[model samples]
Target: MKIGLFGGSFNPVHNGHIKIAEFAYKTLGLDKIYFIPTAISPFKKKNQVAADNDRINMLNLALENFNYNSEVSLFEIKRGGVSYTFETIRYFKKKFPNDELFFIMGSDLLPKFHKWEYVEEMTQSCQFVVYKRSKNINKINAKKYGIKIMNNPIFDESSTKVRQGQLALVDVKVNNYIGNNFLYAKEIIHSLLTAKRAKHCVAAAEFAVLLAKSIKYDAKKAYYAGLFHDICKELDENESRAFISQFVENAYDRKLFPNYKLHQLAGALWFKHIYMNDDEEIYNAIKIHTSLALELSTLDKILYIADKICDGRAFAGVQKLRQLALENFDECFKQVVQRNIDYNLAKNITFSDEQNEINNKWSK
Candidate 1:
C-alpha cells in the first residue's frame, strides 16, 4: 500500500495542481492521493490566501471529476496555526506506519527545501516527489536527499492570476463555485454604490455574460466590466466633479452635463487607479458604457447593450432591443444608440461635445 501526500494552500486550486496529481498517480502507482489544504501557509501573507473553508470547498469542487483514488484531508487545517511539512509527514507516517509515503511538491520549492523544519528526518520518513516548474532540480542535491523528479505537462497558472478576474483560466466547476459563493466579490465598489444601483450592476453583469458568450469574448471580464460600470454613479455632484478632475483632461467640460452622466468616465478611472485593473478592454468598456463611441470593441459594445437591456431597465422598446441583441448584436447596438439620441432629443437633454461628435460621426 502506497500513499501520496499533496499539500498546499489550494487557494482556488487550478489545473496545474490537478495535472500534477494525475501524473503522480499514474506514474507512481499510488493507492491514494491526499490533498492537504493548509490552514495557513508560512510562505504566504495572511491576505494572500482565501478562508480555510473556502479553499477546501474549491479543492473539493476541482477534484470531483478525478477518476483516481484521491481525498482531501483537513489535518493541517484542523491542527490550526502555521502548517509545517514535518508535522504533517510525521502525523501521516504514524497513521500508516507500514505504507510508503510520498510527499509531492513543485520544483520551485526545491531551493528552499533545506529551510524546512526537520528536513533530514522528514526526508528519511517519506519519499519526496518533485513536479517540474520553471526550474530544473539539481540531480546531485536531489539524489543526496533521495528525491525523485517527475516530468509532467507544465501549466502556467497561479492563484493570484485567478483572483485578479482571470476566471476563464480555471476549470468551469471552480469558476461556478467562485461565482456562487461570490468568493472574491469586490466589496469596495459594491459599498460605494446605492442599493438600486447595485441591483442594476448585477443585472447588467448577467446580461453581459450572455452577450459575451454570443461573440466568443471572455465572459468573466465582461461580467466584471458590467458589474463595475456604474460604480461612481451614486457620488454627489461635487464629489463626482472632484474625482473626475484628477483623471480626465477636460474635467470642467464634464460639468456641463448632469453630474450623473459623468460616472462612466469616473468609474473607468476608479477601476484603473483603485482596483489596479490593467485590462484595457475592461477600462474601455466602462468608459463607453454610458455614451456611444465612434469605434467600439466587441466588449465595449456588449457592456453598452447589456446596460440598456438588463432586467432592471424598463423603457419603451427595451424588450425588442433585448431580443435583437441576441439575434443581431451589431444591428441591436446601432438601434440602441439611435434610441438614446431620440430620447435625448425628446427630453431636451444636453449632450457633451464628445457625445455630439460620436453621434454626428455615427449618424453619417
Candidate 2:
C-alpha cells in the first residue's frame, strides 16, 4: 500500500491544506494520507503556534468537510518538543515497513529541504513530493533537486491570512470554530499593539478564562475583555484625550482625567465605536481595568486580576497571586488592588481623584 505523510504546523488548518491533501491523494495514488501536526516546529516560534488540541481539532474539522481518504495523526503532537521530519519518517517507516511511504511538502519548502535534519536518511525511508504552493514560486528549484513536484492548482490561501481575520479562506466549520473560541486572539491583538504588548494581552485573556471558569462566570466574555483591555494603550495623548472627550460624558471632571488612565476610557469607547459592540459588561471591564472600582462585578474583577497576574507580567508575588486567584478570588482581588496602590505610593505616582476614591473604598 502507498501511504502519504503530510506534515505541517497546521496552526489552524485552512482550505489550502485540504486542497493539497486532495491533490496528493489523487496525484500520488496513495491509499491513505496522515495529516501530521507538529507539536513545535523548529522553524516557528513556540508562542506563535496555537494550542495542540485546537490545531488538531481544526484539522479534523477541515478534513471532515473535504471529500478525501485522510486522517489527522497525533504521533508528532503526542511526541512533544521540536518536531523533526527525520524522526517522524523513521517512526512511520517502522510502523508500516512494507508500505511505500511518501513525505509530502510544498514548493516553498523545497529550498530549505537540505537544511532539514537527517534529510538523506529520511529520503531512504520515504519518497519526497512537493506540491506547488503558489503561482509566484519557480518550478526550477524543485526540478533542480530532482524531487517529484505535483502541479496542484493554486488555492492561494494561508493560515496567516486566516488568522488575520480572513475567515473565508478556511472551511466553514473551521471558520465557525475560530470565531466561537476566539482562537486567533493573539493575531488580532498583535496587529494593533506592539509585540510585547500583544503577548501580554493574550496572556491576560488566557488568565481571565481561568479565573472566570473558577467562579462560573462567562469565560468568553472574560477572554474578550482581557484581550482588548489595553487596545488603546499605545495611543498618543492627544488622540486618547480626543476619544475620552467625545465618548465620556464626565470628561470635564479634571480630577478623573489622568493621562495614564486615558486609554481605559478610550479603549472602552473605541471598542464600542469601532465594533459597535454594546456589551456594557466588556466595555465597563476595559474602562476600569487600570483603576479598580468600588463594588466590582465578577467580569470586572476577573479582567483586573488577569491583567495583573497574567504570564507576561513580571513582579514580586505574581506566582502567589496567581495561586490565590484560582483558590480564593476575593483575597486575590484585594491583594492585587493593594499591590497596585503600594506600587503607586512607592513611585510617588500622582493619584487621580478616581484612584483616591477607589483606594478609600478598598481601604475601608
Backbone clash pairs for candidate 2 read: none
Candidate 1, 334: how far from true, in Å?
Answer: 28
Please give the lDDT score for candidate 1.
0.82
For each candidate in the order shown, give its overall lDDT on alpha carbons.
0.82, 0.83
Please, what are the lDDT tens digits per residue for candidate 1 over residues 41-114?
88775555778888888888889998899999999999999899999999999999999999998887887788
| TM-score for each model | 0.56, 0.59
True-structure Cα RMSD, model 1:
13.5
- Given candidate 2, what's the lDDT at residue 112? 74
Regions of model 2 farther than 4 Å from truth: 136-145, 192-220, 226-364
1-364: candidate 2 lDDT, tens digit per residue: 9999999999789888888888899998999999999999887754588889999888888877667678889999999999988999999999999999998988888777777777778877789898887776655545655578787897779888777656678877777677556677567678778888888888999999999999999988998999989988998888787767876676646566777678888888865655345678998999888887876888988998999889978887899999999999988888888888888899988776767998777644
